[model samples]
Target: MMNDVDPQILARYAPRPGRHALLPSLTPQQQVALLCRVLHREGYNDHIAGHITLRQEDGTYLANPWELTWAEVKGSDILRLDAQGKIIEGEWNITPAINLHIDVHSARHDVSVVIHNHSEWGSVWSAVGRVPPIYDQTSALVDTDPVCYDEYRGTVEDSELGRAAADALGEHKWALLANHGVLVVANGIRQAHLRAITLEWRCRMAWRVNLLGGGVPLPAAVAQATGQRTDASGFPFLWEAMARDEIRRDPSVLE
Candidate 1:
């Protein structure tokens, strides 16, 4: 499967044909530009608390520079880090969760995008350490069993803790960092963002249901049947497009 690539030591996986390419290869700046749009759109910039990362074809990862508000972030502000969490480019430092992202990406090569955020509903759900399955088409996120829950112990400060959280992911595309926030891992930025959005919505729905005298959880067989669900194109095109439009129209989200 790893063919048609450069002869360099890290050039094992070939870029898919027909996919867009960056002539000079994407710099950390361009990656940050797209990430600013994502962060601004996702409303995860609350006090500068969330991050998004893209694994480049060169085996390095690009992410937002530490300590910058999502809105204030420019394309030139992204930081590129290697597998060992060493910075290769950019001036800002990496966030504590940076190692967590590196760990997950190292363990799951299929996951090219990683997003961590302390979203509203996600934070609420994480505090309790529970995330129920789908109750609607949007909940189809859990359809493929993409959501995982990790109990809160302490802050994720070291590579070991990050690796442990990655293990909790267990092949799922998303996971709730208990008493903390949410993490989304997918093959593309759109897919990862979609998962994060849907996860927040699901958690909100569950929170509401719980408030109104509690709600019944889905049956095991029903959840399993739901998990069998899949998109014909392996993606939810309409939903993704619509969400992007809304985000673009109102980019000053957290402002």
Candidate 2:
């Protein structure tokens, strides 16, 4: 239920393509670093697990190296790898689970960022093999139903299993890998991070609601309208605010 004035104001304040002349271009490594920092701050890290990958124009990608926990990752610690998961740069080895991102990026030309995490509530929902119900407006951020990969084929180190998970993801922006965790794909690192955070929040909300007999879902039309309204501008503002906060906390992430 945003007023007309709100949309205009949001658009006015939204990050423009070349507005920040003093700030350097957001590089791939910085994208990975920002994603990892924000995700770690939000408690998305499961020890040294979890990863964020950003596709490069050359079909390669920059990813968080396996050696560093999300919280410990700096821009310089991010690794560059070809589409086949071969390390092209950086000192640390890539995560075996990176195969999942490779297959997903190969299959989905539109997606530029992929995030995988064993986040607490997200994994809980995955274990039950259920998508978060449309309980809150934040649930509308997902827009479509999250697909579930029912088969858990161990660690997803193999490319074939990764392809299967990508097939399960298909056109959806989010996928719940049953008994494993969640994966979120988006056109940019910021959006992917936002989706991952929002999806986890929705899962937590659904869990709490289920404990209280579960609330009814919003009508499809209403949900769709709300999604359209928010998708246009809400996420960009949220992403900017998060990036600002993360920069304030640790400016070294840019290095």
Candidate 3:
């Protein structure tokens, strides 16, 4: 028998920060490597065109090396760069385009992790010069509709272009990189990883729906409520499950 529920009691059921207790017991380097392998499996691999960076306690950063594809990256291959962007560790080089991460980190103090990839489906949407309307419920996992950097000033090879893209991203956690790819930012590994995967899936589904003559999206109030439920903690349990697949596929990533 259903009865009137107490609002305070109902609030207790909502997602909380420490609710997902199954966190990966790995170092930051190992975590980054595992996420790269997982993202590669999830279609974020695009030769050597993608990058993931984690800002460190000393204000330096740890990023993937440039010579290898995201799939081939391991903990040992991760690089540490000084705040000046010079490689202070690792046997390989970090991409110059990492300036994009630098700029975003500067612009948004809340972001501790930044991921950029020229993924297949995401690239397709990037060419459209605008965000695809959210038609599916899962796409609502994002904080908001991504800001599109439509100026298309070529590759983000310099600080100026990086700043422009970051400016377009503004306060949003996601962005469509004009004629390029996608950018996802968050304060944790789980959030950033999940957002990247969700952003790509959102674009993939949106395009498919558009081809099918399109359908109506969830109402703003409903979608916003859904996002509130899903966005909290970025579904850490899902991250643990997906990360397990990567760990089982190659145990050496923990190196």
Q: Which segments of model 1 are wrong by more than 4 Å?
A: 1-43, 145-151, 215-255
| Colliding pairs, model 1 | 126-179
> What lDDT would candidate 1 get against the real structure?
0.65
Please list all clashing residue pairs in model 2, or write none if there are none: none
- lDDT string, candidate 2, 1-255, tens digits: 112125576567655786753234666698688878888777587888878888888888899988888887888989999878899999998878899998888899989889888987889989988787878888777567789888987877777887788889999888899999898898776567667887887888889999999789888887778767654344545765676778788888888
Candidate 2's displacement at residue 165, Å, is: 0.8
CA RMSD per model (angstroms): 7.7, 4.4, 5.8
Runs with alpha carbons beyond 4 Å of true place in candidate 3: 1-24
* lDDT digits (tens) for residues 108-227 of candidate 1: 898888888787777777777767545555655445554455656666666677778888987887887887888878776545655666677677777787778776666666755653
* Each candidate structure's count of clashing pairs: 1, 0, 0
Using Cα atoms with residue i matched to residue i, what is each candidate's TM-score against the true structure? Answer: 0.73, 0.88, 0.89
Identify the superior model by TM-score, candidate 1 or candidate 3: 3
Q: Residue 167 of model 3: what lDDT?
A: 89
Candidate lDDT scores, in order, read 0.65, 0.79, 0.81
Per-residue error for 105 in candidate 1, Å, reads 0.6
For model 1, what is the alpha-carbon lDDT of residue 240?
Answer: 33
lDDT of 3 at 53: 90
